[model samples]
Target: MARPSTAHLGVDLDKAGKQVGFISIPHSPHEDAWGAVRIPICVIRNGSGPTVILQGGNHGDEYEGPIVLGELIRDLDPATISGRLVILPAINLPAVLAGRRTSPVDGLNLNRTFPGDPAGTITQQISAFVSDVIFPIGDMFVDLHSGGSSLNILPSAIIEPAPDPAHRRRNVEAVLAFGAPLTVVIDNLGEPRTSTACAVRAGLTTVGTEMAGAGTVSLDALKICRQGVRNVLAHAGVLLPAAAAPAAREPEAILKIPGQAGFVFATADGVFEPCHPLGTMVRSGQEAGRIHHLADPSRPPETLRYGADGMVYGHRQPGRVVLGNCCAVVASPYEGSLD
Candidate 1:
């Protein structure tokens, strides 16, 4: 059954200039019967032009996106743009506040719940509101992320070729404009419920990133996050070029990760020891990592290896792993732009 959408924002999105408010998801808990979960949002409009939706903190543990978007929320003004820019610094408030990958209220991964339910869990309701209400207003959508608390990454962007050729082309252009040090084309891994997948289905040019992680943020990661977002804004014509826009990521290497072969998973619960670091180029069948049985120190470790020749782009975090956990991901050789 199609549940009635209950999420609402406290601000008027149609108004011009900068407006600050919150998307209030009604919550009737034991403490506050009528209190709502407020997700901070900023809508900056200058006349009438393309609408770009910038979303960050999709995963609560990812810090770079939230940090940079918070800066934009506080510092960005209305006079600098030609179109509309809607920014959500911490979209998943419960997860962000709890410092986890899933929402504390519902224990659901926001990324996995797209085209959401109105009368479902709190997280699902938020996703439904965004997908049903806010997404239609966007001409382009950019979502930023990293490895979050569970992994470390190589400051890369993920660009999936949309089923529509036009959408695919536009998305690819947006990803290039993002200009991350490394951009990749990957299949959606058969998951069509992700933010990227949902945006693509909506025919919106979408771009997302997996910049850096280890349950923390970094100065370099912030710089990359800030620059990439600005570049996309400039490219989408939402932000006019400054005296000099942020530097483009030169010498970028584009790779493709097609299907499950690109990933390395832990077969048993153990400590993962990686043989190669992120950004390392390795040949097929190479030793990617090994899982050691810390519980039984005398037992020999079970080795893990790569399935193909590619560049290592992501790895599990904290050197720990559980059975069936993804330990690493590799991408194929560069086939796109250089600078």
Candidate 2:
């Protein structure tokens, strides 16, 4: 028997054996005044074995993952693969094209609206499509992300805790396969709307990765991310394992602090001169940076201090600062499992 033709939009997959194509999900209808758009999903499937997905551009500002995935798609050879590999380089195409953080039409953060409603906004419709069409088709999921906008996150993989111990083990194994220096295991803190959180809730092992800063793609970060993706494929038994390079050091557990504790912001608008750089260690109450009043030459710069003993993970880029803007983030050690 001949294979069935699976065609949607401009993507066609040969479903006879292993097919790779695009699936069009319904979007909000557009009137003559406003036209509806159809979201196209790129799917790569092998006839047999497990299915893995690589999604990027969830936050349009984070460009590394999408660029890396684009390169991977051009270079991938499905003949040697054992399972399905679905790569969606630009999940939020509108945001990516506009170079904005949120969808220009809806102004919604796609990441925060997973498992969304079909009748909701355009973002919700896309989320519903992913949940209905993509989630159940994959055995493993890898949602690629990076620090959006002003944040610069270290290259790391984040895995949410699975109820099943075996699934959790697999999740960790998959993250280890990425070969990133840092791996953070988190349990949803009542934030079940995230894609990773939803995947775990469905009993599927998922891995979330963050690489480089936002707004631009770093070549060094892209190289590391590509290697990580290859490593994941190899680890999942979809592709043959090649000689592995020297592994980076394992990451320490991340300690997420209470978001309600108002972050110390600049009291005066001026140039922010940091007393310490990123990755610096500080004790409780140690001075982190200083805010100099550029407008007044006579006033002394106000010293910024840490609230607890921890490592500096995030800080604002050196520039003119405004009053009431966050200065830096310190990562403190967690005494117990941070779930």
Pairs in steric clash, model 2: 30-35, 30-36
Quality of model 1 by C-alpha lDDT: 0.85
lDDT of 2 by residue, 215-315 (tens): 56767778878888888878777776772443544334544333423144677788877677666777767777889887788999998777767666566
The alpha-carbon lDDT assigned to residue 128 of candidate 2 equals 68
lDDT of each: 0.85, 0.68
Candidate maximizing lDDT: 1
lDDT of 1 at 185: 79
Candidate 1 per-residue lDDT over residues 1-339, each given as its tens digit: 234677777888889988989999999878898999999999999976899999998999999999988888888888888899889989999999999999988889999999888888888888888888888889999999999989888887778667666777788778888867888876657787788788888889899998789898877888888888988898888887662255454323568874688889998988999998788998778899999998899999989989878889889997778888989988886564322
Model 1 clash pairs are none
Worst 10 residues of 1 by lDDT: 243-252
How many clashing pairs does model 2 include? Answer: 2
- For every model in order, what is the number of clashing pairs? 0, 2
Worst 10 residues of 2 by lDDT: 1-10
